[model samples]
Target chain A: MSLAGTGPRRDGPARGRPRSEAVERAIVEGVMKLLEDGVPLAELSIERIARTAGVGKAAIYRRWTGKEQLFVDVMRAAEPPDPELPGTSMRDDLVVLLESLRLRGLAGRTSAILHNVRAQMKSSPRLWTAYHDTVIQPRRRVGLDVLRRGRDNGELRADVDLELLNDMVVGPVLVRTVLRPDAELPADLAERVVDTLLQGLRPS
Target chain B: MSLAGTGPRRDGPARGRPRSEAVERAIVEGVMKLLEDGVPLAELSIERIARTAGVGKAAIYRRWTGKEQLFVDVMRAAEPPDPELPGTSMRDDLVVLLESLRLRGLAGRTSAILHNVRAQMKSSPRLWTAYHDTVIQPRRRVGLDVLRRGRDNGELRADVDLELLNDMVVGPVLVRTVLRPDAELPADLAERVVDTLLQGLRPS
Candidate 1:
């Protein structure tokens, strides 16, 4: 909160040299810890983050414009690399992508932060846009690419909208996460979800 | 936020008879109004609800156990009745159901409350369970019945998991609502969603 003010000249650090990578990493790590601890967004202040990160408030201000900006950076940094799945078939690709998401995307701090973001997005549009652009869209692009490959290879029907197809394949995992945070996602969840979608997309 | 204390004897009201429907209506109305006006859940106190509803604190306490219970009642009251769509075919039934959900479920105060609940569920498991049981499950049952009918008619392949089938059809709308809150769901969205699912489930 209040990482930077909304002044007219709300650019990068007002008058300081760029901080080192070490300092930036510390700040991002601090944010991740707080989110994992299930700290409500309202209570996550810049001052507290500075203290936790062992950096000065001026250092945090020098790096990002505000809490939302900082959150975007943390999410981007924390995002796991796209899985290196073999392009064996559409079904195999989707299963690997989704299982990676469940194991890495929804694991530990990332899962906690995502839950917090879903809850807070409606109330904070600016933050939502930043998070979506920085974190969600990039990951989504990977999913889209997979579907596009399937369509191009004649593994999937050409007529279906790729965006809608993307949602169909991936949406259930997200919905399940939101509804039952404590429940274990079945080991076969990704396989089952993909099979259902692939059946819909198979060329006639 | 403190609707009721977590005391040992935290049963229903300690004394007095059940409140009248008029008083109950006022309180529920107050909760709806505040949610529509964008009051964050953390700031939504029972005292404020009492003031907005023009009812005494004792009146609210007399009926429900806490804010969570009152919220469940409001959601139950606000839910639109299931659409009486013609059971023309599986595709038609699904389109009508999804459209009704978009029009009624994601509109106005109900939409706002849903966004709030998604955010608050982690912090308030008891409230989440109450809301899901009272509001979400009943609507879900209607969707399940539609799938059951489709299977019985031999329109869909019998081997598909009915629960997963329901998620495949309905999950996209919920995901879209969360990701892009302001975007209009296309008129053809439901038809397209159903078509995709049905293709996968078509009898061999």
Candidate 2:
């Protein structure tokens, strides 16, 4: 999910001095810390971010446009590279991947970030798109690849729609995690969901 | 979905004169209109709501504690009574119920209201609880009844977990409707979801 190279390039190189990677890292780290601490997006100011990062305002603006871009950059940097699960059985692969999502949702910071971003999405479509493209799309591609393998291996019915199947497999976990954050997801949720889906896709 | 009499009892009868149903309806309608027009929840003030409803400020306060309560009341009032699907078959019943959810998501006002409430849930726990109790729980009970009938009639595996099955059948629609509001649900989505579930549930 790291979009380090994928994000919009900085507008030209720094005018007077070479860009400092340390400062950039500091800024990104600062943003992450603030978000994890439950700072509302509205209150996340460029000045405060700079202060938190121990960087000057000019240093912060040199690499990114504003808080939205900074936030995107921080998330992109923090996102772990997509896991390359070995070609195990589809059930095993899906369970591993979906369980990771479930666990991530349970993490306090990740959960807060997701909730905040979702709340701000309507107000900031561009930021939402950036987050979606950088974070969500890549993860979905991994799930899609797993399903495609199942189809090719004849584990799934030939006519099954991979896209719909992806949604079916992943959607419930997401709904339970986000909409009902207070409720505990079933301990065997990953196993149960995959079983139901695989049962549906098996040749009758 | 109507929770007219199911919500917490109003504190005693109206103290001064009788509560005006027309005024209450007007306030609810005003809330709906503002939300549909895309007014952010932060901007939806009681003063503005009063003006929009063409009722005195005192009229609203007399009934609802504030905007959140009013929102719950309005949604409860506006929500149509759950349809009785003649129990022709589990597939038919689920398709009807799920499609209704899809249609509700497509409706501008309904969609906006759902998003608004979801965004505010973290900040307003009590309102969220009211919504969950009055709106979400009753609908879930309806869905649970359908699944129960399916199990009893031998359309589903006897060992199937009805609660998990309910999430599987309904969760995808919710995820699509809420998370990916921009994407149109496939026209045959309800049929496809129900078909997949039934295929999985059949005692093989």
Give one digit per residue, the lDDT tens place, for model 2 in B88-179.
98778989999888876776335557556466654677767877886788788999998898788877778777878888888888888877
Q: Model 1: which residue pairs collide?
A: A119-B119, B1-B45
After superposition, candidate 1 runs with Cα above 4 Å error: A1-27, A30-69, A77-79, A104-124, A182-184, A201-204, B1-67, B109-125, B201-204
Instruction: Give the best candidate by lDDT.
Output: 2
lDDT scores for all predictions?
0.71, 0.73
| lDDT for each residue of candidate 2 in A98-135, tens digit (9 for 90 to 100) | 88777766653355565565566546778788778767
Model 1 lDDT per residue over A1-204, tens place: 112232112465444324456677888889888877888776889999999999999878876767778876665555565579788977788899888766753563356575565566536788777766765676788889988888888888778788888887777777666544554567888998898776663234
Evaluate residue A78 in candidate 1 and report its C-alpha lDDT on the 0 to 100 scale: 56
DockQ, all models: 0.28, 0.31
The residue-level lDDT of candidate 1 at B18 comes to 43
The reply for model 2, stretches above 4 Å from the true place, is: A4-24, A36-39, A42-51, A55-67, A76-81, A108-123, A201-204, B1-27, B30-70, B77-81, B109-123, B201-204
